[model samples]
Target: MTELDKKINQHFGGKVVRKDLTKLVKGNAIVPTYVLEYLLGQYCATDDEETIYQGVETVKNIISKHFVHRDEAQMIKSTVREKGTHRIIDKIAVKLNDRKDQYEASFANLGLNKIPIGDSVIKEHKKLLSSGVWCILSLAYYPSDEKDASPWIIENIKPIQVSNVDIDEYKDIRKKFSKEEWIDLLMQSIGLNPKEFTLRSKLLQLTRLVPFVENNYNLIELGPKGTGKSHIYSEMSPHGILISGGEVSKAKLFVNNSSGEIGLVGYWDVVAYDEFAGKTKKSDRGLVDIMKNYMANKSFSRGTQVYGASASMVFVGNTDHSVPHMIKHSNLFDALPKDYYDTAFLDRMHAYVPGWEVQKLRNEMFSSDYGFIVDYLAEILKGLRKDDKTNEYAKYFKLSDSITTRDKTSIAKTFAGLLKVIYPHGELNEQEAKELLDFSIENRKRVKQQLQKMDETFEEVDFSYERISDGKRTVIETLEVLEYGVPATKKTLISDESSVKSEGKNVAEDVPFELEGGQKIIRDNQKGISYDMLLGAYLIGATDIKIIDPYVRLPYQLRNFMEFAKLVTEKKEPGVEVKLHLVTNNNEDYVENAKEAFEQMAYSLEALGILFSYEFDENIHDRSIIMNNDWKIILGRGLDIWQKTGAGTILTNMCKNNDCAKHVK
Candidate 1:
């Protein structure tokens, strides 16, 4: 075991299990991760090898015997009939049978229905009444001689979830892990590899948990698909419910006046709408209005009587266009249903998670280490909903006066949720508090900025904060604004030179630049620093350029080199030919392919009055560019210093707003 694994096992003993064990025991079972983890928590929540092996066998046997599969339903039913009684694992939903004057159960996979169940079971596990809950059920088969009598009966049932958790003990033990360790543990619990994400990216993932811990906190995330946007709500928590965007109605989400019955919001702590962003999708305006009212006031009216609910709302969907395309052509909420596109409705959202920044889920991203069982973590987050730490940052920093009351409330709720997730003990210093505060402000600012684009009447506000100690005010900008060029309305009237002087920094044509040791430090995910901005000024008078980078063999790397060549041609005087030389390594597997690609590139560049030549150098490790005009520039990541723009994306052929490469400089 690695040090981190040992440390987590030592600190959170008995409450943690190896995450991969769930996948191992869940061979052909089509159940959620939490259900498998619940079983693991009962038997294999220890680090001992012998105990884990024995537990794995026991769990596998239990699943093979009890779990019902649709294809094998007939065989299992025959076995149950032959045995007279049997226990099976299935998704059992119980409902009241008015005609029979009792509750009946339905097994989703086993294809059985109207099986009589006891009242005690329904009262004990109430979730079965609303949406089906997975359970281990005892079934009895009685052959009936009467013409209309049925034979299936439910003997007993038990929902697969941890009944309760000691919130105080969970909070007390949180102090033992440092902030980094705690974040890693949470990431592992969510089945993500912590090493593959940045601190900022990890925080974005943690923001998904805000809904579970904060009452009535509304969040929306719209971006490309395959980022696991709905995974947490569906798999990680039993207290939350994930519903199809088209499957909800006023009667199902809120109270049904006809029946006088409360809907999902009254029982579930979080009601997440998945696949919620199709422009042409039909929705009831009344439902949108009611949702907006509930999100804002935490109450809704039914027959002139107001009722309150504590459920937070989450919306996750795919965007039809990229961030830049959306900002330029339409608003960020363009993919939302037409009725939900109102500024008033969007203003109620506390945070707009930038899902585009999250990397696509890959096989390597899943964790194999130890983490707290998700059921335990979910219970802890649910218990934390009663605690309020929204004003924790007030002791260290203050918001700008321009921040409105609504803006402050949104920021405070997000900050409090993050604090509950990361620092439940409230043991954060000024730096820590400031980090959370700035993140909170940026999230709210994202919502407000988009609101301004949708409605011009919405005034722009400076999202800045002042430190209590030195009285220094720092302004926060949304990531999109920094990535895309400043919007026309927000552009400053001053010239570039004056703007740099006023800000006391060196500013490039599009992005902010800092000089350290005569080298530029470009941040990851930064936009606007194109090839022209980086090498345009330096290569103005140079005729001969020598580039040395050993990794210029992949298709993307070769494409980067071609882009640099194009830039050199663009900056050269009319009819002037610039000679470019490249020194790179030749991989044994694709040596000939690399040679052909470079030769093809050379032939292509010659048409543009640029002569490109290349040579193989196996011993070259340092990457640098030498210009004949007495200039030598060092490249921290060679020419491939930008992320690959996916096919059919807005930035596919454009270099103005590509994401910065995350390789070390």
Candidate 2:
């Protein structure tokens, strides 16, 4: 292991794992990442070569022996029945069975529904259960039927985490990791590879759930299909639940008025609507109203009684337009259906995840490292529902005096959820507390800022805050306080007057620089030059390179970005890093597409590790592409240089993977 890897193992090994390994240990089981990692920790915590190998075998054997793969599930079941009992690997969560006087368990992804779970499961395995939270329940079941003898017994029930992440220590430990390490730690915590991510980009990846952890956090992400927008609510942790927008009934989601039964919002930490952007999709109007109220008030009224649920709401959908085109034409809200484009409903949202900002999903996106079985993580989140953390961090920090109750609530909820997830032990110091708080504020600010653009009635308020750090308090506002939102922030703090003067001196003047071999370079327009000319020979010459951009929704757009790298690798120097400085927005609609494009590029660039990385391009107005220590190509259009392909454009005329049009203008 590298020094960093060793540190990661020491800090988060038990609670997290490498993301690539998620698939191997994960089989159809939908449990939280932490839960899987918890189990991996017990069985695979060591970095020792032999131990790591043994642990991998043990985990695979455990999954094979117990986890239900539908095809072989019957065989395993038959073995259990033949043995009169069998241990199984599955995500099992429980609820109080009042009438039966026992906690009953539901097996997630194992093809089993609610079964009679014994209290002994909790009593005997409380620590392990809590650590994994989501467990693989081992039940010994004896069938009454003679002919159809199937094993109903589950065994080796444990949480699925590989790290010992104590919530109490999250804040303290958070400070130690640079933002990159922190996210990698989170990925590791959830079993993802940081190598697959950049520091700023990781924040965008995690920003999807910033709302879930924040209370009444209303966010919307609309993009093309397959961005995995619903993954977090549905599979990342058990705290959230996903309901198809088409299937959600008002009663099932909010409180059922007639029966007064609590609904999904009451049970899950976050509630997300899948396929939320289909304007033509059928949906009940009443559900929209109830959702509007809940998003705004954090409570919904059922009949005469008003009850509140702490679940955050996220809307994920596919968009028909690109961000630039959308902005140029109508607005971000234009992607939504007519009914959902309501000013009132949109007002309730806290942030708008630019689903277009996300790249298509890649195979590397799935974790091969151990993580929680999402179902189990869901249960643990449910368990934590009652323990609110809104005020828990107040001792260490305080909000700006100007902040309102609503703002406080938004921050508190997000802060609480994250605190719950990372620092259940509650040992956060000043900086750690502030980082989460700053993030929470930024999410709300994103929503509020766009609301102003759409609705004139909404007043623009500086939603900034103040926090005490190192015996001194610093107040930051606008978007800059929350990394990557730099372009959006109105204020600028410069270290030196001369540097500031120099940076601020030019609006039209071209800056001059020299690439290696004494090649003079100058860029005048806001327009970005093609990567082909910028690093044409150099990138191709390099052995490897990575481009990091947070947004690349359209497949063609992604290809444009990848073509930039291809240009580099095609150059004179044949063995060097060809990293593309990709910076874009975050949105959900393009998850699958982005993943696909990334993978294809990876395959095509296999001979040379040509990579496309991502980072938030909030200040990307002046488009440019840079090569490692070799060159920088400034452009007017960035990666979006292609003209509308309809006027006899080759890309639109013929869309194929290896088309020459893909090589770029």
Candidate 3:
């Protein structure tokens, strides 16, 4: 086995089984995802393929012989009627029919419902019924030919629990696996190869599965189409049900007002809405309203009574405009239907997974390393929902007072999900904790920022906090504050390779960023940095600062940087070098080659007669780059900081430095 396979085996060996894979691997009899995974748990939980195959056949045999299908549902019923007994394999969900003394059971896929179950089924299966656990039931369907078809058979309806492949014991094993081996193993789990995706991208790719292990999570991802946004919710779990727009209703979701029938949310752990975004896609206003309440409060109203549910709500939609366009024009909610623009419903969202951040779907991202059979993970997540692990991170670090309680809850939910998914053993080293925390804050912050753009009335609150070594409380304005160790991110991005995507890309453009070296530009400090630094102290009150940066193919980045300089030096004396020198990178590949050309361009800076020269170096084999005088720009990756370069990129301003400002005749 590969090293990653070893680590994966060590960590997740007994915890999960990939039941969806059984058919492909062994051509064994097809079975429900939950049942196959359950049987695999007994013999194939190890990383050994030999054992997995053996286990696959074993599970298939169990299903083929024991599991019942719809075509035979009546046959089994007849057999029971004739013999006065029957034993059949199937999954059963029981509901307490308080109106009567018995529990009503439904056999999913068997086309059976409201069957009055034996008292023994009610007593022994009460917890599983209330929670709706997945089980392989030996049901005896009987009807008397006279009064009943026949007598019922008796047998144990055993519930199978798939132990997750053990991930906890594999901690040390992880250190030995090269990123490649680790990736390949993960790919193998998903039945893919590592060569198809980069390690960072692979992890980013895995983030979607996290919700399987987290209950009541609300995550939204919006970007260009074909990023596989609905892949997991649509295919990953038997317990997860995906509903197209037309499939959703009061009866299908929450509680049915008609017969008091509980809906999808009552039965499934995750209920997702596919093709969720549309300017005019009509939906029951009542559904959305109650959904909003249930999402936030986890309870739905029936008449005057409230019923609790734990289903996580997932909404998947396609956007016509790109992320940059939306950020420049309306913010993240730009493409959302008018009704969904409600801040009240949006606020309940835990994180906005920047769908735009992900690249278009690639064939190589699937993992082969053993991952938890999504159903097993679902059960674990549901089990954890009963526990309050949200505040576990808070004990080590606290949120700034500026963040609202709602923000805290959203962040905590995201954080709690991460903890359960990757660190369920609770052995998070400090680095691990921060990764989860930073991710949590960003998701909450994304929702908050979009809210502000939609309606500026919403106050901007910091979603970050500081952890003082001295144990003193420090309130930070943004995540930057938390990363820099001194209640700020000022010294962070430069020193920390992990801090690049701080706050977000669009908002950061307005801020003065201290590039690699200590050369600080006074940009928009409103969000990230000080305007004083991005713009020299002298330019503040000045009418204009002649800005020049040739490589700003992304109209937003260049102009925003220039205008930021103007904002910092707005009060500068006239004719000062307040005139900016953004010595452009003239190559047609400016955006791609922009960073490479910075060093060559930096050499041309002395003649620009500008105090500040924004260098674009896409290539230079060094950690250090020169700045005029004592100031030098030191970057982790140099000018090749951002991923793309395009003229229409969202960088807007009011002066020549601003985007459209220069276009005006």
TM-score of each: 0.77, 0.59, 0.63
Q: For candidate 1, lDDT tens digit of each residue in 1-665? A: 77888988887787888998988999988988888888888889999999999988888888899889999899889988999999998888776777778888888999998888888887787878766788987888998998757788787788887866888887788888889889989999999888777677788899999999999999999889999999999999888999999999998899889767678898899999999999999999999999989999999986877989999999999999998788778878999989988899999999999989888998888899998899889888999999999899899989999999999999999999999999988799998897788779888998998899899998989788888998977777665665564435333212210011112111254332322123344434555667776666777788998998898887788788888888899888889888999999977887888899988988998998889999999999977777776566667567776545221101111111121222122
Ranking by TM-score: 1, 3, 2
What are the per-residue Cα lDDT tens digits for candidate 3 across 1-665?
54554566566657645434554443433344455555666667776678877876776666665566667667656665665544555666777667766666676656567766677865764534632444565555444576532234334565554444334344345455544454454445443445555433454455565566567788777667887777677555656666785567776686767667677787677777778777777667777788789988889896887999777888778877755456566676666666676888888888777666556755444444465555565455555555556887765776788889888988888888767655555556655676667667776787887788777799978555765443534222233222221223332322121233333243233244332212221111122344343324324344322333333545345444444444534454545543344533345545554554444434443244335545444442333222222322322322222323211111212222222223221
Reference-based lDDT, residue 336, model 1: 93
Top candidate by TM-score: 1
Residue range 265-345, candidate 2, lDDT tens digits: 776667788888866777777878988888887788878888987777888888887655654455667767777777778
Q: Supply the TM-score for candidate 2.
A: 0.59
Winner by lDDT between candidate 2 and candidate 1: 1
By lDDT, who's the top model here? 1
Query: Sort by lDDT, best first: what order?
Result: 1, 3, 2
Which structure is stronger by TM-score: 1 or 2?
1
Distance from true location, Cα of 357 in model 3, Å = 3.0
Worst 10 residues of 1 by lDDT: 648-657
> Residue 528 of model 1: what lDDT?
63
Q: Identify the runs in model 3 with alpha carbons over 4 angstroms from their true place.
A: 10-23, 26-34, 47-50, 59-116, 122-135, 139-143, 147-216, 223-228, 234-241, 257-269, 334-338, 359-363, 373-375, 392-398, 470-516, 519-665
Query: The CA-based lDDT of model 3 is what?
Result: 0.56
Q: Distance from true position, residue 102, model 1, in Å?
A: 3.0
How accurate locally, in lDDT, is each candidate?
Answer: 0.81, 0.55, 0.56
